[model samples]
Target: MQKSLSSLMIALAFASATAPQAHAASNEDVVKRHFASLVAGPTPKTSELQMFLTMMPKGGDLHHHYSGAIYAEQYLEWVDKQGFCVNKTDFRINTAAGAKSASCVSGKDLVADNAAYRALLQKWSTADFYNHSSGKQLPPDQTFFDTFGYFNDVASTNGSEGLQTLKKRAIAENLSYIETIYEIAPITPDGDFDKLAAEGFDNARLNAALEALVPKLEASQAFQQGIQNYLAHLQKASAGVDDEQFTMRYQPFVLRFLPPSMVFSQMLASFKLAKTSPQIVGVNIVGQESLNVSMRDYSLHMQMFKFLKAKYPDVKMALHAGELALGVVPPEGLKFHIQEAVNVAGANRIGHGIDIAHESNALAIMKTMRERRIPVEVNLTSNEFILGVKGPAHPLDLYRKYGVPFVISTDDAGVTRHNLSNEYVLFATRYKTDYAEVKKLSYDSIRYSFLADADKKRLLQQLDSRFSKFEADIARALLPAK
Candidate 1:
């Protein structure tokens, strides 16, 4: 009887999943048929197309980093605004003496104001990221990664303004929400930190130095109050943000290369903020995981979380695990990242689980993720940019084949020079997914999002109702006049 009841319950769940569409079947059928009719056509009505795009309910980007979301051009403009000089040959912004050096490339001199130079940088960075050009140099990983240094000055300086810019872009792309990764610290500038440490500092002394810098950090207090400041700033930027517009939340991430205790302490601080700061939803560990220290302490980091979780279980975690591709790490390191994230670190979401196919007990790992419903954050552009994985090489198909929940995300939209819309289009074109499946994927985003239960359900219902109407409208346009 219990087995029979379990079967009945599973059937009921499946039924409920389809029932809403069943009630709205006419509209869905109309869309499916209309799209089918277009297999060999010059496209449908423009207004209808616009509405469809508008109603393409994108779920929240659960794994976005703020610094990676800004447009490269915006950074350049900010650099120019700051009256900084850009190297004529390399385009590196020359900051004030003793300031952090801006990174750029070495090349023949190009007129700084030349439209071609601007376009070249745009092409090199995120602005012209979508343009496919035959003659453009295919960048090495360092060349690509180094772009951040060129713009780091503006990236750090623009802070909230930069976030606002990305937020607007998300809204334009039809994304409904984003959980952006950003750095928050009470620490002094790197130079000051080094200076203090050189002056015979220990951890306690470093803490005192940090406390001294607190006023400096807090002076911007708007940006310096750590996660709380970030929350206030985001709220201010998003104050007029509507339900139809994309919403954003903050995830305070710490560089992993820091001392374990320091990272742990910073992480604890983030968790404390998460408990009270609505905008600050959680914490993430990032940066150069392939480094020896990171790997050496991987288990220790997870154990740290296990300890933190005991104290603050509600503080959410979405981690960067298994982001490495073949040759990126030792063979032994490949098998356990996703597993450790799921089993030990208590990560609710996994970022760039690209090595899923390579892990030991790979199928079991995938099954665990499926059973747990912990979605892998899929950053198609980043995977292609960083790991050389695209199309069939990507795990998109495998994730689907195994029934592992996955959501498309932009890991570093600004850095990779892509957007949420591009990600959708990539999934559609690459996977040969029809519009219904695309719509379903979009809905799945909200359904599986880490939003509060009440909020998630409400957004799911809204997406369903909105999607149904959108399909109906498209169908009405497609049909012959009665």
Candidate 2:
């Protein structure tokens, strides 16, 4: 591992150094440098790769989901150990006898045994996620969302272990921090959809019914106790001396698929938790924002944030906005997500922002973001996988063109099967970025993070020193005989 890493570091050093000059001289020079780095040997270069991989810089994953970022394989492994079955039709895992389903709807058989299940999980996740679209019958979203249930059996009992697994992977990729979203508040087994659907005619009435049910959700000492249980897992996983202290902060995400009132209550409770519990950071409305209720209540949600922002001004807001496409919603809906986030909701950061081109006063919004220093967490892979926005077609270039502050992140790393390095590589190759600019992007991740000012400054200093050493080492190798 160490040897491979060193080689990778050396390869990266050579790649970064030679790439610019070679590209300028001739495109062939660029190709040659790239190839040379690829074949760079393992003894010393592998050590460099190891160093590069293990060099844990203070990272803040601004657009991360706690559940989705954890490996499906790990969860599936746990499920198998617990004796669960993979429902063949949906590809969702269930207790052995409960669902009576098979592998998936596409007719893939469930591998109940450990070894085969592990391999299948790998195929379904980071290992071959970016690669195998050809034979995979699942839609991207379905494939992505489907993993949750497969691992749900194990994850339900393995909270801290799940985070530890996530943190371990993150640290392996040189990330030091994350502010992840999790569903600590459970949606009841008894509070089934049909039961809830039957209670009300519309969202408002549904909310009233849900409010009546709030006592039930809260009454479950199980639900309330789950928060404490999850926190215990965080504390246990994070407890250490020399190891990078993985600071876990939560964003209680309200499902937008629910009626407005239930969703609103969830959001409010999340905001309240942000004030009441140090572990719970803020609130996020997750799921497809392109849905009708989501778009309809967009402004109201912003108003909701406005209320919470007033109550707990210190609480942070990093919302998913402008995750839409031009054709996804009415022309009017595109004009205002990012704007409302800033103007009404007072979001600390914005996620995606892919549809910024269609937004009215987009230029002004970018300018304000630049002036205000509101960082946009850009997940290149998710944009490609979920929304099919990428390359020059992505509004990220526009954000750059207007100098809107941003950072590259893995939105659903486990689902997208990506790491921060891959995200950086994509940005570097696609945008033709410089080392300094890439370093700036890294710095921006921590600098614009929700961490306290002092911590941010300290981490920034650490990043500067580390990047400087990396550059100095690279320059030494590249320098002509002096």
Candidate 3:
């Protein structure tokens, strides 16, 4: 009996030692391994990866800005068509044709001059960031913000055309939706709201002052006509776009550099517009966060949003908070902007939450964000170009580790001379992220989007179908000959 037991034990040990590995490689695993191999070498071409990503189903772009998204070439075309002129000295596009400035060149002449046209492209985008032959080199942060002013008039003139351009670009890139941030122009209010704001930080007086103007502004035929024009532009832009192929929504934003009165009034108008219009989904506050006016009135702006949000609870809010870095603003400035935006203003999604680590009690904020599922819009190229933050210094991994949801985005693809595919490529190459992580980021883009529940479900279903086919194709390619 002892000998028989010993033989059985020996047999069992041998069987355990000889058995194959327990878990087989999943389809995702196989795909990830192939991806790692494809991107293995230093300075890998990644043309194959780019092709794959270009065809890969991207969900939505949530952090886009409409004016900044238009390519500089398109803006130049609009300038030429509008009979505008460009100031050679500063490269500003003047809408009025015959300005009596020595530097002003007619759009026709500028287009004819290849050198000037190329210069305009460089000035209006990050084109000169890497290669600057002449002129003073501006700081990257300043350069990025300054580009907007140069192209503002051209963008204004070509709103619908810009939308059509963006829609076509998005379709070609395989993106399904975009929540673009734009302004409903003629935002100036008849009343002097700035005077009330200059009266110091008195919330009651500001509220009273703005309340008086809301009804007047809402009833203004000009305001109503502006909304109609915006709607018509969208209709015209989306004329032939099939509803199933692509969808878009707008989040009208207020410039934070404006005075408190103007900012508040604009905020009020934005909320009212969102409440009344289906096209405008939410309100956002945008501008250089480090500027004196924006920083000084940061809390005040939050209070205004808080007030308006309470009044119109259904109006969604996405604030551009903590878009600052160390040199951009003093250390103290970084700590509270995101906190106030979240706790005080109740921002549903935080744009460019780059200063999270600098915030006081940041862990608590991360905890709150995780618990509430408050996602951050992560723009990789924009962050690297604007803030000089990337790779380990970036808070992307921190968000993942702490369970805070985030979606990859292109803040201004055209301005940066990049696209969503390039963003995914950077993310994968920089972080060595696996297939599951990459897929989740794409999924989360739509999952955390402000789209209505039914629409979100339908888009998600579309993604599932697309991914299934993608995985199947990948699996078949990876298989060995029978």
Candidate 4:
């Protein structure tokens, strides 16, 4: 039988009440007890706990996407400034007159049309998706992914400016660090390589073909220059920012729906870039996992990682595995994704391991993750919006039950219309998570990050100091009035 939310809350309360009496309560424990009381009340929604969580210092967002993190309104401002046109019919952005095509509205006409502008806002974001009266409701998954395509032009053109915007937003929310997944190299496929990739998935043949391309890629001036340009853009984006207040890192990602040869080449480039660049910390594969090409090449992609990881053992990997739900794919499909990602690809972290219950020998998989200490980047809002998986059905409690570590994040925050604070609110209120658990999650974000050991230690120390101050403030706020 599945556990209900009320039962989960009762279990947590029982655990807290049963603590050993000989030990004195730490500041974190005191804060947790107080917060637990508020949550236990009839209406925790109106309590000050929301304010407390919003102001709390969150350590880092480990699964962010740079382009999808920006608001649609911001993208529109960039569009207007750059003289880009919006297609009134489909609400797509066009870069120039020739690029507008026959179906798109002219830039001047789109600017004058208020109705079209409003439609663009709704179509480009989660603005009107909940309003049944607006006649603009779309399936949540479609709305979430479609936003990226509509705003791709603006996001692609304004890399540095978008970084500045994201930095300012992160500071406002008290976020200490961000590891954003951005595309550094363009996907321009080699014809000879495409023919080889299409030849089928034989490990030996794939290995031989990939080995031949390494020399040519390394020797190409264009490939070398692309890496240089990518690094320069990041440096330009972070020019005057103080690392103490906020820090940023990049993970160059490959689109999973591409042909195997293209995916392998991108992974090769990413690993090479990580070796040479200070800003680029890791590489990840991104896209809808349920796509035909993605599902077909999933195991092949893991093999690719196995091959490359042996070659560049130091390059970090965080694969997006098991983001599917029951209706989205076959039962057999769900059984091995998370397993392969961990056992085959050797992923350091799993993004959106929501289908854990559906995996074959699910308990064994959880046990392996716990023993290995592989963390999951939990994005509550994104999972609910995209997969219709939330509440008691979510694996958040299951991960806790089995001792699997996880850190809360806002995956595509802007697209999902959520922030880090909102994620904390959902987690704490829904799971009845106490303040001590919240603090641990914050610390774990830094602990499980892709940073070097020295940097991780420094960040953890900083977090400890911040939590001490926060606990003191909480004590004063909760005191009885004179």
* Model 4 CA lDDT for position 63: 91
Task: Write the residue-wise lDDT of candidate 2 on 291-385 in tens digits.
Answer: 77788777767766776677678888888899988766788889999998987788889989888898898988888999988889899998887
| Per-prediction TM-score to the true structure, in the order listed | 0.75, 0.74, 0.88, 0.88
Q: Candidate 1 overall Cα lDDT vs. reference?
A: 0.69
Q: Which ten residues in a row have the lowest lDDT in candidate 2?
A: 100-109
Candidate 4: how large is its RMSD?
A: 9.2
Give the alpha carbon lDDT tens digit for every residue of 146-244 in model 3.
Answer: 898898887767666778788889989989889999754336555466665666757777667667867777787877676667566666655655478
Model 3 ranges with Cα > 4 A deviation: 1-29, 39-47, 98-112, 133-135, 190-192, 202-213, 219-225, 480-482
Q: Give the residue spans of candidate 2 off by over 4 A.
A: 1-58, 96-139, 184-248, 476-482
> Which residue pairs show collisions in model 3?
none
Clashing pairs in 4: none
